[model samples]
Target chain A: MKPYELTISQAHERLKQKELSAVELTRSVLDRIHAVENRVNAYITIDEKLALDQAEIADGLIARDNMTPLTGIPLAIKDLICTKGLRTTCASRILENFVPPYDATVIEKLKSAGTVIVGKVNMDEFAMGSSTENSGIKITHNPWDLTRSPGGSSGGSAAAVSADMCLGALGSDTGGSIRQPASHCGIVGLKPTYGRVSRYGLVAFASSLDQIGPLTRDVRDCAVMMNVISGHDAKDSTSVPKSVPNYLDFLNGDLKNTVVGIPREYQSARGLDSDVADAVTNAIQTIESMGARCVEVSLPHTEYAVAAYYVIAPSEASSNLARYDGVKYGFRDRDKSDLLDMYRSSRSKGFGPEVQRRILLGTFSLSSGYYDAYYRKASQVRTRIMEDFKQAFEKCDVLLSPVAPTPAFPIGENADDPLTIYLSDIFTISANLAGIPGLSVPCGFSSGGLPIGLQIMGPHFSEGQLLKTAWHFEQAIGIQDRKPEIGS
Target chain B: MKITPEEVIHVANLARLDLDEAVVEKVSHQMGAILEYIDKLNEVDTSHVQPTTHAIFLTNAFRDDLVHEHLERNQALCNAPQRDETCFLVPRIIG
Candidate 1:
């Protein structure tokens, strides 16, 4: 197999055995990126020279027998994460010329581990849309089919990983951004439990709901990535103060005692695609045959997840994004006559239509006399959603559901319909609402050849179990073996 | 809970966005549809339930209020669209 096609584990084995150099592997991936980037448009930035330099340093480390699993690996970063000296655009024009002076906690960790920072991938503008169509820069196509969307706000990350442009990618999930795209692209994407990974450098979308995780070629790479990225940080007050577990060890555990919960509501959720339902039901049976019992669990508040998420996410987004008013950094409308006019003109011109819509919705929700009717009510419903998860977890070790109602649709399918787009996250948003880990693994392909994702969710801080279960299911089904026909 | 076009315009102004007046009706319709759906949450009796602002409990970390080395002024100003040698330049607020 070509070096670009190697998994993190495979590449590590070859590098340690002197069969493949980090530079060689890096070149192959870069070459693959060059070949497919026109069709995929996976990256917002690709510093080939910088990546080669990092690979050289990794080579020195490997030659000295000072190596970590990711020491010489090349990985893509979602543009939302701050990378010192790199333009972190968050796929928005407001920060088109902006570059960070410091690295995000995740970037610092990746750099310390000697991973080649391949490039920055695109995302939704301020993470407001379910599809990367809301991206202020460009739309990323699904590698499976150029006509279809790869999913969003981390659409570029998912597309990059699926197309082998990058072995792995870091994507932040606010309301199913990572997992939904991963499902659409037929790869493994995990949104670690809230506070499991530090949010210090992640451009905040919904501060309370956002969590950074990995989108990788397979489950093993997912676990390896979780080991490096998951940990508490003193920089972020919301970061949990807990010891990081060796996630790689969880892969060896058997699934004999695992109890998977199938929410009754999910099976009958409105707008669920027939093919996706079949794939998820089959996945449940596959897991059952592998000794993990599937239980019929009820999360009565499941139907309200989309509604609660739209309100709560926009409310947080309005507050978190208020800082980008052309003052300290980012785009500025210089022609405005006064400070207030400047703020209005810069934001109105810099932000895309979808972002403006969200800010309006958020401002409306939090406006006078409307707080109790909107934001507060949403939060109260969110509490009930968390309670639902707590109750469901008591009956099963993990909850199994479809990541999205369907696989990837056409690029402009839901572009004009914001309400329809919001409902696409119904299945995956609950995990974020409850601050629990949610993973999407490729389950099957639609008749149209698009990939379907099966979501596996666990209670807070239960990533270890989620990974092990996903690994077992991956081993049995061999779904990751089905590669997208685009990038390669 | 219908969202009027006037309310939409007011909300847009509050958000510092100058949406085209032509698009206000469409934006208002979309926003109203979303709000009416979220109104479903009102059907659930949440009066007794406490609001969850953050999924996980977090506490403020107190630090010794000593000044620490901060971002270099030049680097901090590097991305500013309008900046002088030291600080960002903005339109005059007090004229």
Candidate 2:
């Protein structure tokens, strides 16, 4: 099998028998990336020499029997992450030349685990859109259907994994950035409990909502990657100090005692594609067959989530993204007079249209006069939505729903309509708002042959349980073995 | 609920951003539509709910103040578009 196509477990087994060296594995994946990356546009930067050099070091550690689970793995990182020497653009022209002086905590952990990073993947500028078409540099196409998007702000990472350019990739989820793309690209994407993973090196989108996660081909790989990337980091003040779990240990048992809730609010809604509805229904039936009981539940405040999210996210983004002034870091225009001109001209030349729109909305909402009406009211609504989730979880172990209202739409379908674009993130944004964990796994395909994803959401710090449920579901459905024709 | 092009341009200035007139008119109309949609929030009663600042229950996540390291000034300035003897160069103000 091609190195890029090997599951994390299979690759580990081959490494143990000395059947493959980290250098060889890394090279093979890089070779595949070279073959197809232009067509997929998965990477913003491919560090061929740097990856091989790191792989050689991993090979030496393995020779001494000092191997970590990720010792020889080659992974792609979303451009939103700060890599010390590489330009982390966040797919915006403003930060096009910005390079961090330090590695993010997650990057530090990945290096410690001996994982070799192949390159940085593309994304929507500042994680503001559903389709990667919002990316200032280029659009990352879906591997399954080239005319469709791979999903955004983690679109390039998802495309990289689906197109077999990398074994796995790291992504950041503000709303549905990870899950939406994973659904679109037909892969497993895990959004660990918000504080479960450190946010130190991630470029700020909405500080309260941004979280780094993994995008892989299967649940097991997502679990392994999570173990390595999660835990407390002093650099990220929001990180939790709780002991991390060996996620692989929890992938046991059918749901005999597990009570999975089917939120009637989700199924009763309009706008859901018929194909996605069917896939989610069939997935629940499969879980029922495995002894897990399904019960109807209500999240009465579901309607308020998206509304609260738009207000809160933009408000936070307005504050968090304030650091990008010309005087501090990132792109600055040369032709400008005085401080005001410098700030305006630099920002005008630097930010893309979508980013500018959000910044304006956020600033207006948070402004002195409007704060009471917009931002304040939204905060109150957020509390209600969180309470709704808390109440539902009391009756169930986890909640199951469709990841998105539909499968990936055609690439340029909603680009012109900003409101239509925001609606794409409706289903997944609530989790971020509630600071819970959610994972999207490919259950089946739409009638048009696009991938359909089933969403599994859990309470705070319930990532282990969520992954286990998703793992068992993946096993029962046996969908991981289904690869795209573009798959290696 | 309806925002005018003038309001969009005003907000853009307050945010220290520059938007072309065409973009301002376009975004103002779109934002007007969205805010009009969200006006439905006025009907829901949220008087009893305490505003949620964060979803997780944990609090007081602080780090020690001791400085561990510092970046070399030259390396920090490497990505600067224009630089001078001691700091970044910008258009002269007092002229």
Candidate 3:
């Protein structure tokens, strides 16, 4: 296998054994990125020189025998994470030229762990859309079929890893940004429980829901990334002070005595494609075969997830994004003379249509006389949704469902209808609403050969259980060897 | 319509967006549809339920009142669209 195709654990083993150099691995991945980036459009920025420098440092660490599991691995970062000296555009023109003077907490941790930063990948502008089509920079195509979208708003991150542009990547999940794309691209992604990973420098998008996680080639690599990125930081108050477990310890490929809850709501969800449903059902049977006890459970408030998410996410976004006026940083409309005119003009021109729609929706919801009817009402429903998950978890260790209603869809399929796209997140949004950990592992493929992902969710801070369950499912699935025929 | 063009424009103004007539009309229609769907929230009675602003509840985070090294003035001003030596230059807020 090419160095770029090596998973994090494989690359780390090779590096530790002196069979491969960090520079060689980083160069191979960079060459793959240069070779396939045109067709994939997975990255917003490709920092060759900076990546090589970091890899050299990683090589030095490996030579000293002071390497972490990710020490010599080349990884891609979703563009929204603040990387000092690297242009961190949240895939929006507003921050197109903005460069942070300091690294995000995760970047600092990754750098300390001796990981090489390949570059920043694209996403939905402010992570507002389910497809990367909303990206102000460019759309990321699915590696499986270039005509279909690599799901978003972490589409670029998923496509990059799936196409072997990077061994693994860090993706931030707000609603379903990380897991959905990983599902569509046939990779493993984990969205840790809210506050499991510090969001210190993640550009705020619905602050309460946004979380950073990993998209990797398999379950073990996801655990490797979680070890490095998951922790509390003083910079973010929401970060939980709870101790983190070594995720690699959970990957024993054993499902004995595991109680898996199959939500009745997801089994009968509207618009769930037959291929996705069959894949999930088959995955459950595989889990059962491995000594897991599968039981039917109800998340009664599942139907309201999408509606509550739209109201709550946008309402928080409108408030969080209010800082993007023409003053401190990012794009500014300098042509306007009046201060108020500049604020309006800068924001109107700086933000894309989807972002503006969300802002407008948020503003409308939070507006006087509408607060009680919209924002407050959504919050109450959110409470019920959390309660539903809490009750379901009482009977089961982890819940199983299809990551998305279907596999990757053709680009521009739901572009014009925002509501249609919003409905697509029905399965994954509840995890974020309840602040629980969720993982997406490749289960099966659609008739067209697109990937389907099985989602496993657990209560807050139960990432260890979620990772273990996914690892067992992945080991038994026998499809981990499949690769998209991109840049080969 | 769940939302009118007038309300769309009003919300846009409140959000500090300078939307044109076309955008206002389009957003009005779109928001109307989205709001109609969101009205589904009313189907569930939450009369006695408390609103959850955050998924995981935690108390306010506090630290010792000691200053640590932070971004320099230049570092903070580096990404500004317009800046002088120290402060971000903006359109005059007052005469």
Candidate 4:
């Protein structure tokens, strides 16, 4: 097998035994990236020289008896996270040529741990769509079926990991950006409980809902990457101060007493793909057979989650995205007169159509005349949605649901119908709204052979439980070892 | 709850985005459809509910206010399309 096929743990062992040198592994992965990246549209830029330099440094560290969890691993970063001197576009034209001068908190952590960053992966232009078709640059296709999308705004990251372009990837989940794509691409994506990971330096989408997380091939690697990236950063005031746990250790604990909740409301009779529904149901049965209990719980306000998220996300986006006004940062039109004209011309030429639509929706919601009727009302509904999750959690330790309504859909399938695009995130948005941790893992395959994923959500900082439940289900179903045909 | 073309134009102005009339007309219809679908929230009795702004309860992630100087000004403006010696250059702001 090629070095890129090894799990992070296996890679680490190989590195220690001198069976694989960082340079060799990095080169192998780089070669794989060169082979498949164009077809997948996974990378906006590939810093071959920089990645090789980092791998050399990691080799030196290992030679000196210094090793970290991420040492010598090749990782991809979603374009949204700013890396000093690297062009961070967020797949939008507004920042088309913008290069950040400082590393985001996540980048700083990755560098410290000796992780070799291969490149910036593509995302939805400002994270506005479920399919990467919204990328202003280009669309990322699913490795499972090239005709379908790899999902977005972290589509490129998912596609990269699924295609083994990198050992893992860092993606920011504003609303199902990470988990949904992970589901579509058949990989593990975890949105750590809000504040478990820092948001500093992540280009703000919705300040309160966005989080940086890992996309990898397995759950243990997710936990390991989570340990490396999770923690308080003085730069980000929103990051929490809780002590980080050894997530890998927690996975070995007994799960005989685990309780999984099946939210009755999520089992929609309409609009849900029958294959996905069956996959989730079968997953629950598998978990139940392992001496765990599955209880039917209700998130009564499940319907309001999408509505609330759309309002609150856009409102925050309107405020947060205001930074790019053709003045201090990003694109500036060369032929404009007056400040207003400059602002108008730069933004008009810079932003994509979907981004413009979102900005408008957000501005209107926060406008003086409409604030009470829209933004405020949405906030109130957001509270009810949180309450529904809280109430359901009281009945079970973790909530199980499908990560997306279906598996990967054909590219441009929902491009014209924006409402249908928004509904694609229905199952995963509530976790972001509640500020809790949610993970997506491959469960079974659709009849068409595309992968289906089941999500396990836990209360804030209950990542250990979430991982344990997912691990238990993974063991029971015995699907963790299966590889996709894309690479094989 | 329906959004109209005039409202889209107004919001576009506030956002500083120059949308063509046809784009505005298309988006206005789409936005109206979405709003009408979400209007089902009005039927739910939420009068007694409290609003949730942040999911986590912690507040005030305060940091020292000391100045932490960053990238040189030139580096910050390196990506700008047009720039002068000291600042990013834009179209003349005055008539």
Model 4 CA deviation exceeding 4 Å by range: A479-481
- CA lDDT, every prediction? 0.90, 0.87, 0.93, 0.87
Pitting candidate 1 against candidate 4, the one with the higher TM-score is 1
Model 2 CA RMSD to the hidden true structure, in angstroms? 1.4
Between prediction 2 and prediction 3, the one with superior DockQ is 3
DockQ of each: 0.85, 0.69, 0.91, 0.70
Alpha-carbon shift of residue A328 in model 1 (angstroms): 1.1
Q: What is the DockQ of candidate 1?
A: 0.85
Question: By DockQ, highest first, what's the ranking?
Answer: 3, 1, 4, 2
lDDT of 1 by residue, A214-317 (tens): 99989999999999998989889899989989998899867899999999999999999999999998999999999998889999998888888888989888
Model 3, runs deviating above 4 Å: none
Tens digits of per-residue lDDT, candidate 3, A1-488, equal: 89998889989899999999999999999889889999999999989999999999999998999999989789999999999999999999899998999999999999999999999999999998888999999989999999999999999999999999999999999899999999999999999999999999899999999999999999989999999999889999999999999999998857888999999989889999999999889999999999999999999989999999999999999999999996898899889999999999999899999999999999988999999999999999999999999999999999999999989999999988999999999999999988999999999999989999999999999999999999888888765555898755
User: What's the DockQ of model 2?
Assistant: 0.69
Descending-TM-score candidate ranking? 3, 1, 2, 4
Clashing pairs in 3: none
Winning model by lDDT = 3
Tell me candidate 2's interface RMSD.
1.6
> Roughly what TM-score does model 1 have, to 2 decimal places?
0.99
